[model samples]
Target chain A: MIKAFIALVRRDLLLAFRHRAEWFNPLLFFGMIVTLFPLGVSPEASVLRVMAPGVIWIAVLLAGLFSLDSMFRSDFDDGALEQMVLSPYPLPLLVLAKVLAHWLVSGLPMLLMAPLLALLMTMPQDGIAMLEWTLLVGTPLLSLTGSIGVALTVGLRRGGVLLTLIVLPLYIPVLIFSTNAVSAAVAGLPMGGQLDFLLALLVLALTLAPFATAQALRISLS
Target chain B: MWNAIWVFFHKWASPRYFYRLSGAVIPWLWALTLLLLLGGLYLGLFVAPPDYQQGQSYRIIFVHVPSAWMSLFIYTFMAVLSGIYLIWNIKLADVMVRSSAMLGASFTFLALATGSLWGKPMWGAWWVWDARLTSELILLFLYLGYLALVNAIEDTRTAARAGGVLILVGVVNIPIIHYSVEWWNTLHQGATVTKLDKPSIHVSMLIPLLLMAGAFQLYYFSLVLMRARVELLEREWRSEWVREMMGRGSDG
Candidate 1:
């Protein structure tokens, strides 16, 4: 079972790796959104520094959302999902594998790119580290929770906007903790508390969200 | 005793039985609701002494508190019904969920509207991004989203299953909404009734609040049963029992 799970994860990673443009669109989109923030706000470094955490967090969130719709879409289209459901391996593990691949492709790249964006926004050095660290813990929660949304909407004819409407509110708690963590880090306050809170949220989402996502897939397949 | 309870539950699980049973109970339920609402409103508006600080405008709690309580109560009820539907795969539970969604949305709307009305008098504004208020607003959005999801899907079974899943997912937000004020520094006031040891409100105030809460419960039941009957008809239109029901209605 473990072998099958690793194989599925590896296969999804290879598929994501082969489609290089699919991987880059979210990065480019993230860069473009970060640039737009400087244009929309004043060009002053102080102002950008004040808004940096919020701006960077929102950009990463949008990039994560953009990549989410494709999580199960391609598999559903080509009958791969049906085969997976029928396979000897458990469906929930398959879902977890796909979510891991999604994080690797979409979430990790955005986290790695945060420092560069932080420099663009004139964020303090500690703030950049906090942003990267929070994303490291928080974005996986987003990916897992978001897979539930993606699975729920996969069978719909046009689910893009509806998916956003359904999922964005769920993202609010994560947004609050992640941005607050960065803010705490920037102010040189004790951030251990907020980081622990984010980790708690991540743990909670990791435990419950996959079951819900797997159930949603069953409903869609039916 | 177990057999008897099972029989009772199973009987209600039949839509026809539920429709007939609800028809018998709804008139009494409506009458109770009307009596309690009128009595509660009169006492709350005029008889109950005004607050030492906020004055007569605090009377808005007559409507607002009941609506807030109803919103939370109904969502918990809906979640339980969704759980039943998931476990039993009973079509009746699905119909109950469809019926409850509209009523839940109505109560959520009442909570928001009356909250705004109260806010204008107290906070000198119609809206504030207070934590409790924002969470309640999100609750309204969740309701609307659930309704839209169910209506968008054409297949009845698919709609029920999908809507059920959405409700289950959205249930996570309810606790967050309830505790938002306590967890965060916000403009909204803290709890008056939900405290563990003692409720903060005076007995005179608490009495009318309890009465109005009872009225809201009956109001929800009367409306949900009425709507569930209609939902049953639409879902079972092709069944023999529905044909017989239609024929009997025509003959009468």
Candidate 2:
């Protein structure tokens, strides 16, 4: 099972790298969204400082949304997903492997780029660490939860808009907690509670989402 | 008793039997709904004394509270129906699930609209990012998501089963979402007074609230059953019972 998991993850990662443009799409999109906030909202440091946490998290969210299609779209198109479903190994394990690879390609780039974007937003120095921490915990949750949505819509012809409507609601709590934690840190307040909440939600998404995704994949593919 | 219960469920599972049973039960439900709505409206709007704090505008609670409650109640009801459909693969359960989503979305919309109307007079703003209000809005989105998913899929049974998975996911997340929003609200707002946190209301106000709640429950059942029957007929149109019913000229 472990070997299958690694092999699936490696295969996905290799596929992601070979495409090159698709993996870079989310990072470029994330950068563009973060940059737009200053022009659309304001360039004032004080205003941006207050809005920084929410702005960054929302950008991360939209970027995650942008990349979700790549998680299962290729494999599903080429019939690799059907093969995975019929393999001797459990489907949830394989689904989790795909989600992990997705997070590494899409979610990790956003996490790495967030601090630079934070500085661009004039976010306070003290909050950067907390922002990174929240992303570290929150982004995986996004990937795991989002896989369920992607799997459900994998078979649809025009699933992009419908996918956003379905999955964005599920991401609200993560956005709330992560932004709250960063804002608290910026204000020199204790952010432990919000971080803890994010961690709890991550744990939840980690355990339940893979099975739900596998089930949804079956339903969609059927 | 166990054997009888099992037999009852088995009979109820049949689409034709369910069509007849709901046909018989809906008139009573509609009658009860009418009675309760009239009584509750009279009591809630007129006989109930004015609040010391907000006077006449507080009467909106009669409509607002019940609609909000029904919104949550119907989502939960959908989740349970979805669970049954997923576990037993019962066709009727899936029909009910399909029938319930639109009603749930309407109630959620009603809740948000009424709550906003009430807020404008009371809070001096049409909307506030209060925890209850935000969570209700998110609940509305969840309902819309379910509807969108059901519409997007071409195959009916597959759409329903996929919708079941979405509902189960939403149900599990609702509490956590509510709590996180509440905590976030408090962190920013420093404990504002919650609008509906009535610990000790007088009997006069409480009576109409409960009456309205009962009225909403009956109305929901009546409508859901009516919709369920229509859905059942549409899905089972090729079945012999449906053809016979059509030939019988819509005898309810």
Candidate 3:
């Protein structure tokens, strides 16, 4: 089972790299939205500083959203997902492996790019580390929960908008906590409680979401 | 006695039996809901004395609080029904979820609207990130997500099963969402509870709040039954009992 998990993750990563454009899409989208914020809202540092946490959190979420619609699309289209479902090893483990690969390619890039966005927003220097740490914990939870959404919608041809409506609500708690963590740092308050909440949520999602994604994948594909 | 109860439930599982059973039961539910709502609104609006703090405007609680309660109640209820459907693959449980989602979303929306309306007079803003209000708004999005999943699929059974999985996932997040929202709300503003709680209001106000909550529940039961019957007819349209019903012939 562990071998199968690695093979699935390796295959996903290789595929993600082979089509290098896909890797850059979420990154470029993240950069563009960060750029757009100043145009839409304001260019002043104090104004951006006040709005930095919310602005960066929302951009990361939208970039993740942009990438997730295609999470299961290629696998489902190529019939690889159906083969995975029929395999003898446990399906949930395989699903978890795929989610891990997705996070590495999609969420990690967003997390890496977020610092540049934070710089653009002129967030206080002290708050940057906390913001990065919050995203590190929060993004995988998005990937885990987002997989359940993708698995449910994988079979439909016109699933993009509907996918957003289904998945974005599930991201709210993560957004609220992660953004608050950064805001606390900005306000010079103790950030432990908010980070602890984010970690707790990540643990909950990590334990529960794979099984659900596996079940949803089976039901949708069947 | 246990055997008889078991046999009774076995019969109740049949769509034909349920259609008739709901028809027989809903009138009583409707009558009860109407009485409670009418009585509750009258007492809540006129007889209940003003709050020392907010005075007359607090009466919106009659509509606001009950709808907010129903919002959470219906989602948890949907999770229970979703569980039953997932385990037993029962057709009726799925039918219940199909009808319940829209009603739940509307209640969530009403809660937000009323909560905001109440906030403007009290909090000096059109909206505040109060824990209850924020969580209720997210609850609305969750309902919308479930509805979107159910409607997006072409097959009824597939939609029901997929939406069921989403409900289970949503249920796991709800408490965490509520807790996080509360924590976030407190981090920004000082510690304060929203008006949904009753410490400030007297028993005269409390009675109507409880009554309205019960009335909202009864109204949900009747509405869900009515919608369930429509979904049953749609799904089972080509089956034997439905054919007989459509032919104006007695099945028994």
Candidate 4:
């Protein structure tokens, strides 16, 4: 079982590496959104500083969304997913492995790019580490929760907009906590409470999302 | 007792039997709903004394509170039915979930709309980002998402099962959303009736409130049953029972 899980993760990562555009698209998209916020909202450093946490978190979310469609699409198109479902290993384990690979490709790049974006946005230096912490904790939650939406819509021809509608509501709590934690950090206030909530959400998503995603994949494939 | 409950579910599990049973139950439900709604409205709008505080505007609670309650109730109800459908493949459970989605959405909308109207006079704005209001808005979005997903899928069985998964996911998130929103900000009043302790409301206000709540529940049942019956016909058109019923008359 562990071998299958490792093999699937390694396979997905290799495929993601080969398709370099998949890795760069989300990063480029994230950068573009951060740039757009300054142009679209304001160039004032104080305003951007105040808005930075929310702006960055929202960017991560949208960028994560941009990449979520690929999680199962290629495998599903080529019939690899059907075989995974039929494999003797429990489906959720395989689904979790794929999610881990997806977060690595799509979610982790956003984390690395955050400091540059934060600098560009004039975000306070104190908050940068907290921002990274929030992303470290919260981005996987995004991938896990988002895979459920992607899996549900995998079989459909026009699931792009519908995917946003269904999944965004579920993302609200994560958005609330992570943004609060970052802002608290910027203010030099106690952020333990908010970070704790984000961690709790992460744990919840980690445990349950794989099963739900697995079930959704089965339903979509059926 | 468990045997009796199992027997009841087994009997109602059949589309034909459920259709016949719901046909018999819906009229009584409608009649009772009409009675409760009229009596509740009369007592609430006329007999209930004007509030010393907000006066006539506070009366919107008669509509707002019950609609909010029904919105949450119906969503949870649909989740339970969907859970049954997923586990046992109960056709009627799927039909009920399908029938209940729009009704739930409408109730969620009504709650938000009425809350907005009430907020205008009370809160001095049409909408406030209060915790209760935000969660209710999210609830509306969840309903819309469910509807969009179900409609997007071409196959009925696939749609039903997919919707089941979606609703179950939504149900799990609702409390988390509610708490996080509350933690972020809370301007809306706390629960007056639903708390475990005796309701904080005056007896005069409580009576009509209860009456309206009962009316909403009955109305939901009547409408969902009517919609479920139509859904059953659409789903089971290839079956003999539907053919026989079609030949009889337009009336169920």
Say which candidate scores most in lDDT. Answer: 4
lDDT of each: 0.86, 0.91, 0.88, 0.94
* Candidate 2: tens digits of C-alpha lDDT, residues B1-252: 999998899898999999999999999999999999999999999899999998999899899889989999999999999999999899999999999999999999999999899888888899998888999999999999999999988889999999999999999999988888887674222322233665366789888988999999999999999999999988999999989988888775
Which DockQ-derived CAPRI band holds candidate 1? Answer: medium
Candidate 2: tens digits of C-alpha lDDT, residues A1-222: 899999999988998999998889889998998889889989999999999999999999999999998799988899988999999999999999999999999989888999999999887788999999999999999999999999999999999999999999999999988998999899999989988888988888888999999999999889
Model 2: per-residue Cα lDDT at residue A131? 97
List where candidate 4 sits over 4 angstroms from the true fold.
B1-5, B250-252
lDDT of 2 at A64: 94
Sort order, DockQ high to low = 4, 2, 3, 1
Ranking by lDDT: 4, 2, 3, 1
Write the residue-wise lDDT of candidate 4 on A1-222 in tens digits.
Answer: 999989999999999999999989889999999899889989999999999999999998898889998999999999999999999999999999999999999988899999999999887787999999999999999999999999999999988899999999999998999999989999999999988888989999999999999999999998
Cα-based RMSD of candidate 4 = 1.5
CA shift of A67, model 1, Å: 0.8
TM-score head-to-head 1 vs 3, winner: 1
| lDDT, candidate 2, at A139 | 95
Clashing pairs in 4: none
Candidate 4 lDDT, B1-252, residue by residue in tens = 999999898987898898898889999999999999999999999999999999999999999999999999999999999999999998889999999999999999999999999999999999999999999999999999999999999999999999999999999999999999999999998888878978888889999999999999999999999999889888889999898888787765
Model 2: docking quality category: high
Candidate 2 chain B superposition, TM-score: 0.93
Name the weakest run of 10 consecutive residues (lDDT summed) in model 1 chain B: B176-185
Question: Judged by DockQ relative to the true structure, which candidate is superior, 1 or 4?
Answer: 4
At residue B66, candidate 2 shows an lDDT of 92
Best by DockQ: 4
